[model samples]
Target chain A: MGKVKIKKKETRIDMTAMSDVTVLLLTFFMLTSTFLQKEPVTVITPPSVSEEKVPDSNLLSILVSPEGKVFLEVLGSKDSTMKSETVRADLLKNMVAEYKKTHPSANLAFTNKEMETFSKLNAFGVPITKMKEWLNLEPDLRDKFLESEQNPGIPINMNEDPNNPNEFQMWVRAAYNSMNPELQESMVKGRGIAIKADQTTPYSVVNVVMDNLQTMKMNKFTLMTALKTSED
Target chain B: MAIKSKSRQKKFDTRIDFTPMVDMNMLLITFFMLCTTMIKSQTLQIALPTNEKVEKEQQNKVKQSEAVTIIIDGKIDEKTGLSNPEDGMLYYYEGMPETDRLAQGESNMEQVEFGDKDGLYPAIRGILMKKNEEVVKRIADLKKEWKEMKFSKDEEKNDSIYQEKAKAIRNDSTLKRPVVIIKATPNASYAHVVSVLDEMQINNISRYQIDRINDVDSAMMIMVKAKNEKK
Candidate 1:
């Protein structure tokens, strides 16, 4: 081979198109993202063939762990007249009144700041006695408290008496009463209260929750389940 | 004059690097991926009777000929203390067991495997179809009529007609729909009970109750389990 001089070429590659594509993807994700609510205990709901989607708003979700611990999450209505903040404030007020009726000495009063914080929360399950302390904690400390094993769930005893109900039943009743009349009507028409439970939870645990709801005269409710895959 | 001309002729590079911008975008994408929940869960709607004591007269209202009872049991390993879904079993019977097969010294318990290749659903569906044959046929006819009326644009006329037909089908005294009573053992997982409830929905069953497992049912379950283990 003869010795020949080779031409020099620059190796610079254009990344303008790649950057544009990435920007588009980032914007799409950012716009559509709804952050996952931090649950005290994670549960894998059972799979079923039902196709009805859980309503995005005006919902009271009952979360049940495999250990039978229960938590409550209330998603308020998006309409201007029935905002979540107002509903939550009313619910807290009613709950305090109810609590005081049973335990006259217990101080269930919450400051405006605490009520505001409680309104913004996606899920809550601490007993009424500990709720004041829980609400007063710093945000980071509150997360730690909720995730800790010492966090006793809302007190749910197997009390089937419609007259003297458990704390869980009290919360549910408050939630139902705090809604606007229209929303309450819709709830009676089977448009509210969804139960999300772990697949491995025993039937006894679930039955207790159901019985509690029944005692409150909340006969109609929805059960949240994952979509069943074809292979299953 | 020469220095002024040289100053006027100066040029600058206009190209900008985007590596840092791309890195920032990548970080945001990751954040959103971690925080976002993409799939909305599905829901199964159910209505339960109020928690009140049913009187003896009301309890006797349900006819034995039109009743089906399903039992769910869970088997937990003694060593591991863990429940396996495969170990769960469902037993079902038609009518009252005391007067039926139990009187013949054969437990009326029929085994139903959860999610077997040809499983619990098909068998239950067959029984429901046989029991509700007249009502199902009537509902089908009403649906056909409703569809034709819709196509003919008889909106007001179709509405009342459809409602009347639906009420008749629902209240047909001669049509016998088996009342399903579901009983689960203490160890049986919630998923198994949900599966059976889903079957009722699929079969369009209207009358069903989730009741506690009685002592007799528990004894039958134990007997069935013992016999199966021996086999």
Candidate 2:
């Protein structure tokens, strides 16, 4: 009797099809991706059934933490000469002017380099008095300071008199006066400003921001929310 | 042409390994997937009355017969000092509040509980739906027609026509619709406020406005809370 001969088979497999699929997936992700903006505080907006989508550009979004801290983000026209960076720089200049109106003796200024750095940031909320010091810190340290407890966000309170606007109101005015007419027009129609707050935040905390806006005569604004189905 | 007998030729494999290339692409795809935000946030638009004080005669008044006020209040957790959205109270009153009878612990205001996950408060929904019965009935009939594509053969055309008709029915002045005035105390959770606003959309009531909790409202709420707790 002869022993059965064992069969030899090649062990290698082709990966070309796998590679093709992966590359196609990579292309899709790259095309449809919108990078999430970095914020000092993470807030989950309350859910609603309103179907209006937040505008991509020419918006001034206010971020309110549960602790009542506030931050401001600005975006300019999408296809205009007035880009976000340029508008941010102009806003800085206008803020400086606004601060000087109330405190003529306070010494506050930003160098061109500092302004450039500020323009690239996604959100800013430090008090105007400490803006220079905050801007001069290292990027890592600056972010820490912004999230720290000592950070008093944009000096807001219940100020009914528009003649004496609070720091938050001043920032809004500066954004409105920037060289972008589209922003101003939208603000008038009540679509330019958006309030983003945590779902668990107390109404009192949000009321302060709303009252400030109302006093500024910006009676119209939008509230940011996540989508919720009816059955939820 | 002495080719030197085509010196010993060697055959090589034609296929190249693509394992490393696929690995790199998989890594890149993971990075992009994590960095991207696929769902954009939605927005709720609201317009508040101007803060400037208006003259007594210049201020427009709502007819008392068509007014419905809803107040949202929540309890603050002692440990975290944060309001609990799940633990909240809803109070409503039709027409005007009767402060004159407050001394006797009696008022027109009544306390109500929020509905389950239905989004629309069941108790309040019944009241609002009855108040705006004419509009709701007509809108329901139109919605059925819309579902059947009665407006047009084209799907998009039918949808546009349905939307236009629904909007008209909501704004029709001839309908006896209720004016909803929403108020929230300082301790109310923001979620409750938003849910109340969402109800306006669901009920198709277009005359709702958010007003601040005045002193009179606070007093009335205290009375209602005391009355509710006693029961």
Best-matching candidate per lDDT: 2
| lDDT per residue as tens, model 2, B98-171 | 88988898888888886675455788778888998999999999999999999999999999999999999999
Worst ten-residue run, lDDT, model 1 chain A?
A: A179-188
Shift in Å, residue A129, candidate 1: 1.1
TM-score of chain B of 2: 0.90
Q: Residue-wise lDDT of candidate 1 within A147-219, one digit each (tens)?
A: 7778878889788787887899889888878856655765786668888988777777788898788878888
lDDT of each: 0.78, 0.89
Residue pairs clashing, model 2: none
Q: List the residue pairs that clash in candidate 1.
A: none
| TM-score winner | 2
Error of 1 at A23 (Å): 2.2
Model 1, which residues run further than 4 Å from truth?
Answer: A1-10, A229-232, B1-13, B52-59, B76-83, B99-105, B117-176
Instruction: Estimate the Cα RMSD of every predicted model relative to the unseen true structure.
Output: 4.9, 3.0
| Residue-level lDDT tens digits of model 2 in A149-229 | 999898999999888889999999999898889999999888999999987899999999999999998989999999988
TM-score of each: 0.83, 0.94
**Residue B178 accuracy (lDDT) in model 1:** 73
